[model samples]
Target: MADQSSEEAARLHKFVDPVSYLSAFVSNGVRPDGRSCSTARNVTLNIGSISTANGSAMVKLGQTCVLAAVKMELSNPPLECPSRGYLVCNIDQSSSSLSEALSGPPTSEAQSLSQTLQDLLSRFVDCDDLILVESKLCWTVYVDVVCLCNSGNVWDACVLASTVALINTQVPAVNTDVELPLVSISSRRSLKLGTVPLAATFTIFKDKYCLLDPSREEELICDGTVSVIYFEDGGIAQITHAGKPLSSERLISMCKDGQTHTQTLYKLLNTVCT
Candidate 1:
């Protein structure tokens, strides 16, 4: 009898108005995933998973899995920024990643996500560190992010993977002498990344409730969302809100809540990366 009732409820949830269905759960101070409104899902980080790449990591935010790999390529520096290299970031999501079986070209959402990640990483990474010979040549760091599974809150998982992959990266040493710079694969050096950058996402339900690390189902029914990126140096890399309007006090509170998660991420990275 209990199993039958549970199955009927699940069916109703799928076909009924998602917001109304979700409201029933939220009113009780819990989400369908059994997490409280303010609680985020567990995050797991594994580094150096891809041996072929310069650096790599796999991060899972609950069930969402994202893999990030870094590759170093030598190229001429940009004319305007002659001393700095490039940090290229890309996000690739396949049919397996989504609940819906999407095929063919990359979706606009994926492109937008890639651009957002690129912007954030570019701001966090000191490109000058990649300089091999000032204006002449420099190492271009390519960060490729692939989504294996997107249960929910994939954005946070991607950020974690990208940052951790870069943390694990070791650039090859270049001998600047002679006609052309000679690269020594045997000699490599790790990047000097100061403070780690991390992000947290929240979904606003109704006008008052804020749900942290929302799952796919919750996101579908959310009224609005807030994404916070913390630099860990008393600075925010980015804060974006979508869906609905949020008040100043609520936004500030959400930012503070996000910071705590970011700090936790930094500590977790330190433990695994070191």
Candidate 2:
């Protein structure tokens, strides 16, 4: 009898107005996944999973998962920035993760997501640290990430994966001589990373509820999403959003909420490092 009732309710929630159904659940401080309104899904972080890459990490938040790998190569510095090397971040979402799969070329949404991640992450990484030699040769750190799943809170998952991967990365020593520089794979040196960067995503549903680390069902029915990126220096580096506009008061509260999570992430990373 209990199973039958539960199944019927689920069928009603699926076919009926999902927004209203979810709203009712939220107001009661319960979600379909059995978590409280403000609680986030489970997060699992694993590092150095890809042996071939210089560094690699994978982060799973509920059903959403992202894998990040770092590769370093010798390259000349840009003309304008002669002293610094490159810190590039490239992101790709698998077609299997899409709800309605598209044929032909890659979707514009995926391209836009990659560009957004690149812009936001560029500010947090210390590109100058990659410079082995001033102008002759430097390390180009390529951060390639692939989304294995996309249940929700993708931005936060990517941030977690990238940060962990960078922490695990090691650059080989370079020999600057003759015509060109040569890399000594035998002599690898770890990157000198400062405080790791962190991010938290807040979602607003309808015009009322503000959810933290929303799930796919909540994200789909939400009005907008605001992601706040926290820097090592105890300041927000970037705040980007999509969908409807959020109020100033709400945004401030969201930042505060995000800061708390940033602290938690730092603690988790510290454990990994040790």
lDDT of 1 by residue, 1-274 (tens): 9999998988787678788777888899888778888788898999999999999999988888999999999999999999999989989898998857489888888899999999888866789998878889998999999999988888999988999998899888889987888989999989766567788899888878898898988887778889988886647877888977888999988888788778888888889987
lDDT of 2 by residue, 1-274 (tens): 9999999988797668888888778888887788875677777889998999999999999999999999988888887998998888887777777675465665776677677777766765678887877876678889898888999888789888988898899888877875667778899878766656788887888777778888877888888888888865558877888878778998898888788777777778878866
lDDT of all predictions: 0.87, 0.82
Q: Would you estimate the TM-scores of all the predictions? A: 0.93, 0.91
Return the top candidate by TM-score: 1
**Candidate 2 regions with alpha-carbon error over 4 angstroms:** 101-104, 232-234
On a 0 to 100 scale, what is the lDDT of residue 243 in model 2? Answer: 76
Query: What is the Cα-based TM-score of model 1?
Result: 0.93
In model 2, pairs of residues that clash are: none
Off by over 4 Å in 1: 233-235
